[model samples]
Structure formats: C-alpha cells, structure tokens
Target chain A: MVDVTAPPLSPTDRSTVRRHRDRQRADRAELHAVLDEALVAHVGRVVDGEPVVLPTLHARVGETLYLHGSSGAASLRGDEPVCVTVTIIDGLVYARRWFTQSANYRSAVVRGHARRVTDRDEALAAMRALVRQVAPGQEDHADPPSRKEMAATSIVALDLTEASVKARTGPPGDGDAVAAGDDRWAGVVGLATRVTGVTTCPALPEGTPVPAHVPTG
Target chain B: MVDVTAPPLSPTDRSTVRRHRDRQRADRAELHAVLDEALVAHVGRVVDGEPVVLPTLHARVGETLYLHGSSGAASLRGDEPVCVTVTIIDGLVYARRWFTQSANYRSAVVRGHARRVTDRDEALAAMRALVRQVAPGQEDHADPPSRKEMAATSIVALDLTEASVKARTGPPGDGDAVAAGDDRWAGVVGLATRVTGVTTCPALPEGTPVPAHVPTG
Candidate 1:
C-alpha cells in the first residue's frame, strides 16, 4: 500500500489561506471529490439584515451549482446577494489535546449572485442535474414533472466564483504536543451516510416490484 | 427488529414547530440518537451585515451545547445574536424521480444569545465536555491548557432554547408511478467515514504508548 503519510503534492497545496491550517487545501483533487459526493449544501444569506442558512439539495455541474426551492421561499427568491457554502466532513480529527483536535473536512465557500432560472430548458436541465446528483440514475426511470409541479418549483443557479476549498488531515498539527512526545493517541473517526433498504410508499400497490433505482444503499 | 416503516411517533413529535413535513422527523428516537453522537457543529451567524457560518467544535451535555472559538474572532466576540444549528446527515434519500430525491438528515436549529465564557471553571468544564463529546475518555489524559493558552482561546456557551429537530428517511416519493409500475432503478447509495487507525506524528519519540482517550467512532 502507498504510504498515506507521504505528501500527495507540494507543501503549498496544504498551506492555509485565511486562518492558517484551518483554511488550507490538502489537495485540489481531494477537494473536488468531496464536492462531487455531497447531496446538499447549506446556503447562508442576509435578507433585510437577518442571517439565514437554508439547507437544500444541490448539484454541481462543471463550475456551477443548482439549487431548487419552493416559489414562495423568501430567502431563495429574495433579491439580496448570498454566500453559499458546501461542506463534507469525511472524518473527525481527534488529536491528543483539545486545541489540536479538529475535523477532517472538505468545504467550498462561494460568494456569488443568486440568479433565477427563467429559461425553461435551462431550468429543466438544472433540475435534472440536481436529481442526478442526489441519486445518480434517477432521471430516466420516473415520470417527468408535470406542468403544475414545474410551476410550483423555483430553481436558482450560483456561479462557482470567488470560492476557496479548505481541508485538513493526518495525525495532527506539525508543532502540537502530540508531536512533542505527548503520550496520547491521535487519529480520525469516520462517519458515513447509509441507505438501509427500499421503502415502498403506502400508496403503492401491494406487489409492486422494487425498482433497481429504489433499492436502499 | 422493529418495523421501521411503521409510524415512529405521534404526528406532533414527528413534525417541526414550523410544520414542514420535508423537515419533520420520521423517527423521533432516531433523531435524538443522531444528535447525541456528534461533538462539533457549524454555527450560522450574521456579522457586519453579512452571513458568516463558522465551523466550531462543540459538545452536547444533556440539553445544553458548549462551543468555543477565539475571542479575537470577530464573529464570536461581537454583540450580535447568533443562530446555531447542529446537523447530522444520516443518509441520502434516493427517489425514483430527480425531484423527489433528498437527503436523510437530522438537525437541531437553535436561536440564542452568543454569550462569552468568562468563568474559569465553567470554561474548563465546557472544554472537557467538548473533548469527551467526540472522544469519550481523552479529556482526563490530556494536559490542562496553560494560562496563556486559556487567555488566547475564546469559548462561548449557547443555550439550547428555542430549538427544533427535523429529519427524513427511506425511499423517494414516486407515488402513482410506483403503483402503476415503471422500469427504472431507484435506490440509495451509502457513504460513510471510515477511520483507518492512528498515524503517529514524525516528531513523536519512538514507542510512546498511545493514549486511551482517542475517539474510535
């Protein structure tokens, strides 16, 4: 096996940008991979001086992300600009001491305009991207959204500009007590999202065959 | 095993105060179990008319949650009120259609005053609680923070008042499509965080016994 400790790239790749190591990237590829795996993102915005963070499903296609909300959601449809952040905490970094302990995470902070998708084709495509993102093969099997459903939904696209990805991994910080002969164990504890099995909706027929796409993880 | 498909609890307990089904708890006990398992929370707050969401390590002891940050950090020191939300995405819900696909998540949203921790003993107890939150036994093994380190670190305590928990699970909502039958796969893909043992810092002396306080979740 490859030495996981061996640095994957130059030291610069892991250097922090804002709050030291807290604002650094372990690797560019690592960052993108985390983004690809997430199903939703927490979007924070200030609407009339109130800060609101809304958790909604999202899809990242190329350099842009698409999020959908009800047409009546004030924060989604509000005119104020927003800052969108997508984070995937892969593991908990547990070091010897409290100060040195941190989370092993991949996060992208995006500051951009929240544009409404008015074009029918563009809006539909964004929705498709979101569906595919949450469950990879979902779009082909189900009935397309009815005109009424489409009318009720509002999609917003945020351009992925002025964004920075930050992450941290390994035993602990370089200069921590753990490195200075502190007799303590230091590593990570991982967590995962699991699908137990397919759940037939009560409204479905008694003998309905479970669609392959509907199977639980 | 219990029939998870059966209704988990009363409608009131299963629903949010806001009465959003999409944000309601399908399994009440499951929601509490998820929240009790984690130690860190990403708090969303407004700073200087802008939305700033900061990732702070936290500990939950009963109904109270303890959070710490640098006193010099503008957001934590400022007098403005803050909204702290603790979320654990249990699974990814895959619906037959793209629109119904969503995340199976458990989250607690708390709105309260972000008060600073000034008492020395209370601050220490909060730090210990936070360490034990993630790693159950490590707080006793680690050395206490020195006076200088204590002054440098900024800790905040947020009461869990005005809070609500919500969650969703199982397959996506396909309704009539599943009843009539469709030839498409629809299912969830499980993603998990896996810890792969401890990695010793290069600066550590050879053969130091690993402390028992390291978290293994």
Candidate 2:
C-alpha cells in the first residue's frame, strides 16, 4: 500500500532499496513501527576493515534509537558509522516453485554514526525506554538503576534520520501459476513472536506471585 | 554449561567474546542450533567503508550457510566479507533493577567471504534447503525452479568457520535483591516463534484442502 510511490520518506541513496523497490516504505511512522515491534536489532560496524554484526536489545524514543550493551563491549564505545536493522518475520510463503517461495516480513534498516549517551538525563530516559521497550509495565515495577549499575551499562544512541522499511505481505507471489493450471498447493504459514510462559526466579520464594505486568503464555 | 569455559571452539581472535565470557558457547552444535531455530537473519557487509545490514532468508547446510536473495540485489553480488547474525529471544527478563534487567536469548554470529553459488547442483540443493528451512514439508510439495527462475535468484555460501554463539538462560541476574527484602516482583516472560495461521492463495478457489506440512497456529 506504500505507493514513494505515496509514503515517500528516505533521504539518503544508500538507505533506499535498489531491488524490490515496491516493498520499500518511506513513511516515518512505518520506520518507527518496525523498530518498536521487534525485541532485538542486528548492529553492524566496520571492525579492522571487516564488518562485524552483533545482536542486541534496542529501544526507540522518537527519532532516536538506543542499543543496550555492556560497558566492556568494544563495539558499543565511541561514535562510529553503524547500521541497525530489525526484522519481524510474518509468515512463510509456500509458493508453486522454489524460486517464488518467500517469507512475508517487515524489516527496517537504519544507518548512521552511533554516539554514546553521555548526558545523565538523556541516558536515564534512554535506559527507562529500553526497559519499557521489552516489557511495558515492568519498567515501573523494576527499581531504577543504581550508580554502580549505570557505570557497568553502555547506552549508545543512533538517530533515525536515514532509514528505510521494506515489507512483503499477502499470499504467494506466483498466483499466476495456479491460473496456468498447476495443481500444486500454495499458501502462507504465518509466524509470530509469542509469550510461552512466565518462570519465577528460583531464589525468590516458591509462591512469589507472577507480576501482572509480565507477559504470560 | 558451555564449559571452553568447556566447548572452546573459536579459532580466530575476533570470534572470541571478551565480555560475558560465561555466555559464549564454543560448541559447533550451539552455533548450528541458533541458526536453525530462527526464521530470518541479519546480513551485514561494508559498503563504501560504512557497514550496511539487511535482513534476509538463510539456510545452513553442514559447514556452509546459504543466504538467498534476488539476483539484482547489489549487496549479494561478488565475493565480499560479511557478518551473518541471528538472534532467538528466549524471554524477557524482568529483574529487580533496570540495570539488571536483560533478555534471555541465544545468538550466533558468523563472519566470512560469501561466494556466489554458481554450480547448478549446489544451487539447486541450496534452494531446496532454503525452502525446507522455513517450512519443512514444503520443499517436496513445491515444484523445482526452472532455468529462468534459477537465473533470477542468487545463493551465496558462507563458511561457518569463524563463528560464535552466546546464550543467557534461567532466573534474573539479581536474586540477591530479593534476599535484601525488596518487594519488587521479578521473573522471566518467555518468548517463542509460533505459527499463527494458514492462508491459501486468494487466486486459488476457497476451501482448497489445507496441506499437512505447513505449520499452523
């Protein structure tokens, strides 16, 4: 339905998709939705002339994206050119042929220099957003970070100025094969991220009531 | 329980995890397990010196991992250095403090020069593997790709030679806070990839008997 075609939004050439331009969504809201729906992001940066990609938890606050990592993590330090991408696998498309078989997915790719959040207030807000991003009401239930804990955590913020979203939806791409009288079965097997269960900590008392804020199966 | 800390399998200096050594799993099996369980992977490569990461479909065959893309996708062309990373979020950990809150996840990172699959047999095998990876029984159900279809597809093989896996499980990291008499509730909200539904192609007549192989909600 993204007609840049009507939702036109990407500013940079590199952020735009060359192939399957039809799947590209330039809407800023579409960009934010892709980042917010997923729990993890694959962060990449050139390390010694080679690209290194690592998966980490991410949170989005308006145009800013914050990635969570350890203070000792080398990739998270310093302002460096980076790419952060998140994908939500919607379904597996079983088409008439292997070439046409595909997955229905929504993915967002953000490229920019990542800067460590140095200001205490900004860092505090980002930290709260990170916790809330993963488990909504749990942010209020969890204690605020202590001074020592903050020292051990690293929060790097990357602006979402240059970003693009690509998504493929609906049935198999080769419906014409059926029109050609191919009897082969074709359909989509949907996939989703689900909460399987809530397991309490062993150290906590056995009857420790499961918090209402936590997602349960 | 990956004890190199016992499974010690990383051969290169960069593949080793400097932080959270306890979470790094060196077993080859662990790396394979992480790749097989996830439906999508984030592929990263250096483009004009800045790193670029995009999500795509992938299938693993023994020591080789195959990434599928359109023939026109520039990033998938030529032999280039890449980092393929996949993350399976096991659960959301709600800890006593924001600092201690974390995700229970298993992730794998593989780095190598991806070479195009030119040989027809290898390409065909990789294509079948790719289909089966997403939906097991569909490989047999779907028709094999024709010559023109093969020309429009690209399969790149990257060796699993340089790779590492990291996983975190069990209760929250801060059980001592409970011992300190903090009334805050803390536990794990498990997450999993699930099949939500099956939708047949719209072009095909409705009430077409659903196949047995596709995963369903």
Which candidate achieves the best TM-score against the true structure? 2
Q: What is the alpha-carbon lDDT of model 2 when measured against the actual structure? A: 0.86
lDDT of 2 by residue, B1-217 (tens): 5343234457888999887899998688888888998888899999899999988889998889999855664567749999999999999998888988899999999999999999999999999999898889888988888898888888999988888999999889999877788766788889888989899899888788888887667
Instruction: Tell me the lDDT of model 2 at A27.
Output: 77
The per-model lDDT (C-alpha) reads: 0.62, 0.86
Judged by lDDT against the true structure, how good is candidate 1? 0.62
Write down the DockQ of candidate 2. 0.79
Candidate 1 chain A lDDT trough over 10 residues, lowest sum: A7-16
| TM-score against native, each model | 0.80, 0.95
Docking quality of model 1: it rates as: acceptable
Model 2 regions more than 4 Å off: A1-8, B1-8
Each candidate's root-mean-square deviation in Å?
7.3, 3.3
lDDT (10s digit) by residue, model 1, range A1-217: 7544433322332122446545565454554566678766777776456565667777777666778755553448634566666677666666656666666676766556688888888888888888777666667765456787788678888765445566665555633564455555555566555554555555555555665654355
